[model samples]
Target chain A: MKIVKYEDIVLKVKLACLQMTTDLPQDVQNKLEMMAMQEDGQLAKQMLDIIIENANIARQENRPMCQDTGMVVCFVKMGQNIQIEGGLLADAINEGVSLGYEEGYLRKSVVNNPIDRINTLDNTPAIIHYDIVEDDVLIIEVAAKGFGSENMSQLKMFPPAAGIAGMKEFVKQVVIDAGPNPCPPIIVGIGLGGDFEKAALLAKKAAIRNLDEVNPNEKLLALEKELEVEINNLGIGPQGFGGKTTTLKVNIEMFATHIAGLPVAVNINCHAARHIKVVL
Target chain B: MATIKLETPLTIDKIKDLHSGDQVLLSGIIYTGRDAAHKRFIEVLEKNEDLPFDVQGQVIYYVGPTPTKPNQAFGSGGPTTSYRMDAYTPPLINKGLIGMIGKGKRNDEVKAALKGHAVYFAAVGGAAALMGKCVIKAEVIAYEDLQAEAVRRLEVKDLPLIVVNDIKGNDLYVEGPQSYLKEHK
Candidate 1:
């Protein structure tokens, strides 16, 4: 069995969280450049330019691209053949998060509760999702999810009769209603076929796909294109200032589900889609 | 569009002429407050107590900034979503506050109140890093226990912001799109 020290995991988690906050991934950068070329609206194009420049400035200066900085969300995959040599695995991850938020000078946005509402000084208790795989390596993927776009996400379970066309309409309506609020030239992540909650989970997960990458499933890819076209048709261009480039891309992830359930979830990721992956 | 610079404790006629699309560089003291602070402020208003700061002709920025580092004035400061303040806005507008700065659309109730009170402004949403640079001074004026949610008075200079909403009921989100929307065939 492969043995991994707890200290190593803790350090890696902390590094990953800090990296996710202050850095914009290279893949997202390349896609934004490409989209900037294809964008037709003068204002939308300018907005994209400013966003790209803002990202560059943030990176060069070691500053956060946006103020929200977001809540820490980690996706961990543990290998079945490996054993953690130190304290609990979860505690290690939490320690990394605490160190990263404090040392990185990233914003502490986590509130104690939804109602009484108190800010948790150090961003902690990261939202973690785990899966055990056959290999020995531990993989951690974290995204600092901001409040603007996260607040716009929605999930709906439709009757079987509603089908794909219904989904297209729902997504279109959601985009129209969302208008320029979620920050246009946004990425739409759709989760189909899973049960209600699972669909939402998958939808959020689907956002990790590179903005320019196409889904492997041909049918799903076509849906992505169709939805992109329909959403841009809303004329809600960049910064909601209007133009033909309302959405940068539409990504759909699907799974098999019960015969009677037609569950779908739509998670919107703003232009600043920040995430990072590490293997230890 | 005219660009104007004003220190705080200004009067209504000064802001009344400003419309959506005009640019403004504001100097002087503006209070920072977001969702939770708005709720609390309205509660104080409901009790008919003196507000933590003078509200007459003052501007409230809908923001919750990152904590300031040692000796730093403020961390990255940017606007939060405006709709979250929708429920409490009309009353604040009814009081003498003349301008509100935030990102995103306002409800019709808030829009009407803006027209009635001659108050509205907006800033780009994700421009926090750049925005923070413009804040020259910041200190917690009230609700220190609220931490980031506290009402801190800030001094800003040449802070760039586009007017998304105006006292005239003009809106950039609606007009900006209508002016630029193309027919898809």
Candidate 2:
């Protein structure tokens, strides 16, 4: 069995939180650069340039790229052969989040309760998803998801009759309706199949996937390309100032579903798509 | 496009001269508030009490900044989504709030209120670090308990913005997209 100390996990999570908040991922930065060159509108081009400059400034100064440092979401793959010593895995991750936010001077955005609306102060109790795997290693993928785009996400449990065409239309409508609110030049993640919650989780995962990575599924890859073109045609542009680049990329993930149910979820991510991964 | 230079406590004549899609470099003192602080502002108004600051001809930026590090005037500060504060905005606008700096769309009532001698400007959302450099000074003036959502008085120099909504009811979000669609078609 492979043994990992609880404090080790805490340190990794804390560093990931601090690093991801300030540094724009390389793939996202590349996509932004490419889009900036392709944009037809002067305003759109200017906005993209400013966004690139902002990323550079954040990196140079080690400052949070955006004021909304976001709620930390961690997806963990834990092997059955691995044993965590010192404390529970969840507790370790939460402690790391609190320390990371405090030490990095990141905003404590979490509220203790939705209704009560009081600040948690430490940005604790990160949203964690666990998957047990056969390998003896533990992998943690972290995403700092801002709410401007999160608020724009939507899910639909469509009947079987809705089909691919219905799904396409639904995705298009979601982006159209979102307009300027979610901060345009967005990344779209589509999750198809499974039940409601699973689809949403899949969409969230898809949203944080690296832009340069290729999808192994040929059909879904083609669909992603088609949707990208269609959405850009909507002319939402950078910051919705209007241009050919409304979305930087469209990523889709799918799974098998019940015969009667065709569930779909869409998660929109702003240009500051912040995520990082660590393996131990 | 020529960039317009603007100062705070905007006049009616200045607001009327502005148009949708105009780039602006703003300077002088402005107040900051987002969801929680805006709610408190409304509550205070409902109680027939004075606001933490005078609203007349002043601009309220919809932002909740991160905590500042040593030797910095402010941390990464950028505009939040403006639509969330739409419900509370019309009342503030009616109380002589002449300008707003934020990102994204405002509701119809807020747009109408803009027609009543106000303007809405959109800063590049998510460009917080770059935006922070423009804030020469920041101090929390009210709702200290709200933490990041506290009302702050900020002095900014050459803070970049785009006029999204002008007093004549022009909306850049609508026109900018429509124009692009037309040109491509």
Which regions of candidate 2 fall more than 4 Å away from where they truly are? none
When summed lDDT is taken over every stretch of 10 residues in candidate 2 chain A, the lowest stretch is: A176-185
Model 1 agreement with the true structure over A1-280: per-residue lDDT tens digits: 8998899988998888767665778877787788789877776677778678777867776777788888877788888998999788889888988898888788888878988666778887788888899979788888888878888888889998998889888888878778777766688888998798889878888766677576899999888988888887787887787777777789999999888989989898877788888788
- Kindly report the docking quality category of candidate 2: high
Q: What tens-digit string does per-residue lDDT give for candidate 1 at B48-166? A: 98789878889899888876767667787778888999999888878888888887888999998888475666666676777777899998988887777789899998776667787
Q: How well is candidate 2 docked (DockQ)?
A: 0.90
Native-to-model Cα distance after best TM-score fit, residue B169 in candidate 1, in Å? 1.2
- The number of the candidate with the highest TM-score is 2
Model 2 lDDT tens row, B36-112: 88999999999999999999999999999999999999999999999999999999988999999999998999998
Q: Model 1 segments beyond 4 Å from truth?
A: B1-10, B182-185
Candidates' C-alpha lDDT: 0.80, 0.93
Worst 10 residues of 1 chain B by lDDT: B176-185
Docking class of 1: medium
Index of the highest-lDDT prediction = 2
